[model samples]
Target chain A: MSVTKKDVNYVADLARLKLSEEETESLANDMNQILDYMTTLEELDTSDVEPLEHVIDLEYRLRDDKAKEPLSHEDALKNAPDADTDYFRVPRVIE
Target chain B: MSSSVNDNYEAVIGLEVHAQLLTESKAFAPVSTEFGGSPNTQVSPLCLGHPGTLPVLNENLVRYIIKMGLATNCDIARKSIFARKNYFYPDLPKGYQISQYDTPICHDGHIDITTDGVDKKIGITRIHMEEDAGKSIHDQDPFNTLIDLNRAGVPLIEIVSEPDIRSAKEAYEYLKRIKQIVQYLEICDGNMEEGSLRCDANVSVRPKGREEFGTRTELKNMNSFRNVERAIDFEIERQIELIESGGKVVQQTLLWDANKMETRMMRSKEEAHDYRYFPEPDIPPVVVTDEMLEDIKEELPEMPDVRKQRFIDEFDMSDDDAQTLTEDRYLADFYEEVLLHAGNPKAVSNLILTEVLRTLNDRSIGIKEFPISEERLAGLVQLREDDKINSSAMTEIYNAMLEEEKTAEELAKEMNLVQVSDTDFLEPIVDEVIEQHPDEVERYRNGKKGLIGFFIGQVMQRSQGKANPEMVREMISDRLEQE
Candidate 1:
């Protein structure tokens, strides 16, 4: 499949990115090149090989179901761009 | 339009339910997963997506999911991987949710639900584990949307159902069964109102006998079971109307306005997220051992269907009573405990169905907070069985028991509500009533047979409601016949 400018713009919209015309053109070209390079893997013949989900073969590391101390309210909102006494405030978000 | 015209199409529905696991801590972080704490007080650095923080899986989360899988007859995957679903939302601290994409933990499960006296099996496509985002309260602030990260990093399991539901009623049954199973497994509280359990439905409609499905719309924001059914019904009608008007059904994401009872489009299919999924590098794939599966299987409680069948076979209960009793786990247990003491299943079931449930509703308390002990309730039932109290006296004693710590017998004695079956004690009252109500007696002799109720009422009043009604009726009938 070929990457098109419309597809790039649509993706950018979903990602909440404001892309200019020049940037959209360059990103579309970059995506096409990446797709072309990925097609090289289609030539490899490994019909019997199982698809890999993770690179490292490791078992899950699990912790007990215990609660630890969480951050205080003051520390939790320390880095908020905007906040009230307890909540992290953002510009009104409506669907 | 006529009913026949609306019946020309069939609606196809499938539901996706997200159940928040009742684990003590968040999915990956050590922050508390308790609900309704102060805002942001339950967040850890990892939950906030601070740099240099790594996630570790909670052991109970996996066990809880496996328990659900076994209960629902799911094929548990031996190896499951977590993937990062890239998205941007204010509630998502990490800007991407750690979820399962291709390798879900459970798959190929089927749950049987009975709707309209017909049992149908809804196929489960998959159950994947994921982390919940924080809450955004838009109504709390006038100018801003307030975010609470306490719910972030909470563990959740998304159960995806195959498109097998044929109507809104069937969808309702499917959701109820799912909630019952989760509550029985003790993994989720199954409170849709509290947001612990959430459902989103995909709905489509097609001409009758058509095989190819129409474009489907995804519906969200239904907070209750009734709303789920209502929304599906409204959407089906809307789609059918759209199709009949020469307009095609567009694939979109719609939010159900519960008050308005209509669905409004949130976004179309083109605006759907790609969710560029990749394996989460911070956590490793979960490997289920045979021993672990066996242990979880051993821990599985008796499911609702099996308990319902057992109640029918063992207790000789009616199908409806068994179903009503087994709908809630605690209620079923209470019924069983009463059975152990009362030894009469039908009677016990009747009492619970009427008096116990009425009291519960009147006081607005759950069965757990009910004041009457199971043993005391059984004792009351036993008293009625032994003819120590009549039905009215039984009700009075029950209401009294709710107020104070007194036995049924003690309450019966204190309130002078015991049944007086002895002939000598009731004969005088019967004779006096017969002598005093001479006109009624003559009318009774003239075959006004219904006056027996009035005579019984007088005798009961004179005896302070302690007269055994059956005995009084027999004695009074015998004396009147002597004339």
Candidate 2:
């Protein structure tokens, strides 16, 4: 199976990825290749195979529910491109 | 007014709670789940849904969910499956969300939430594991938005409940009970403001005694417990009005505008088939052994409900008081420590629940951050119990304890809060008060019984608040009778 040009654009639109034409074609090819590889599982013919939820069936490990200090305003806004004195700055949100 | 309240319409409420598991690592990858981190810094290749990247389950998350299942008395499935829920969003780097579909790890549970002298069981249909989507900030602009992947791939357990709730108050109690359970299990932080735990309510109204269900509206983005209750109440009323006015209640998803205090339609509700789900083939199926289950079961702590009941039976505290004390593990532990120190659970519960809790609430403080140690609180209760300090003096010492670091005993001693319990010590002061207040004494002698309290106050004023009221009252009454 292979991804058509339409399939490439559809996935890019769904994921909101601003993909160039070349990038789209390349990703489509790569995903098709991966999907092709996954087709090997069909040969196993294990219809009754059960899926696993957890690797280990352990019960409870709990942390002390104590309140701790949160990050400072500056630290919290470290990654934001724009920040105000106490908040991360953004444009007007409402009309 | 909601038609449910006016007419014979019964509101059916179900809650979908998404609790971010308190794991140090992300759900599908080993990235740190710490809050307020740099955006996209913690995202691994799998979380970003990069090509050729596969998700590996975080072992700690599974253990946490199992612990919750056991605490809630649910059946833990020996097998379960992870399916990809296909959706498109900028923050969801993975075009589809990797979540549990049909088979969940836990199923068929019930939580009994008691409120207003009524016990009601809210049925939990399933608790399934899933990865959280990153946050979308629409404040950037009306037409533009920014994405923060810091919360992406955080492990979460979605506890979906049956529509067993009847009112907004019942919904609040159910959510509160769930928060306590998760917090007690040490699985989730249960902080609604931080988005660690969130509540989504599916509300509908049916004519009373009708077997058919009403169309439901989903309410989301509740930042606090009060908002959850308020939004549901408003939506229920809105739907009831629409239905009563000969309009059909359309099923849709709504975002709660906390500032506006109204629910705005976000999108039409999607059915199960809308998100095309298929088993994720990248990850292999997980299998567990009986030995592992037994080992995990052994590590379970005594749950909140069991501990609350035990407090009532063991400490002989009233059910209402016991429930309040045992609601939080830290407060419960503090109360237990006070009992250990004072050897009087009854007095300890009263002081902690009534005095300590009231003070904490008044200051908007949490018990985990309470400054006074349990041993010190026990000292205050002991002083009052032993008549070392009168009740009036106890409040003064309590304040001093907060402002300073002295033990309750030391402060009571230093501030002269020791009660003058001896009538011999008090009789002299009482005589002085009577001699000074001759007019009042005459009025009391002329059959004014209420003036006895005034004479007692005079004695207390001469001795400060340290004089025991009972002893001073007896001395003054005897002296007046003799006169």
The candidate that achieves the highest lDDT relative to the unseen native structure: 1
Candidate topping TM-score: 1
Candidate lDDT (C-alpha), each: 0.91, 0.80
DockQ of 2: 0.10
TM-score between candidate 2 and the true structure? 0.80
Candidate 2: which stretches are off by over 4 Å? Answer: A1-95, B1-6, B38-54, B140-144, B267-273, B421-427, B439-451, B477-483
Interface CA RMSD, all predictions = 1.1, 8.7
TM-score (chain B) of candidate 1: 0.93
Residue pairs clashing, model 2 = A52-B286, A59-B296
Prediction 1 TM-score vs. true: 0.91
Candidate No. with top DockQ? 1
lDDT by residue (B354-448, candidate 2, tens digit) is 77888899888788778888888888898888888888798899888988888988998899878888767787887788888888889888999
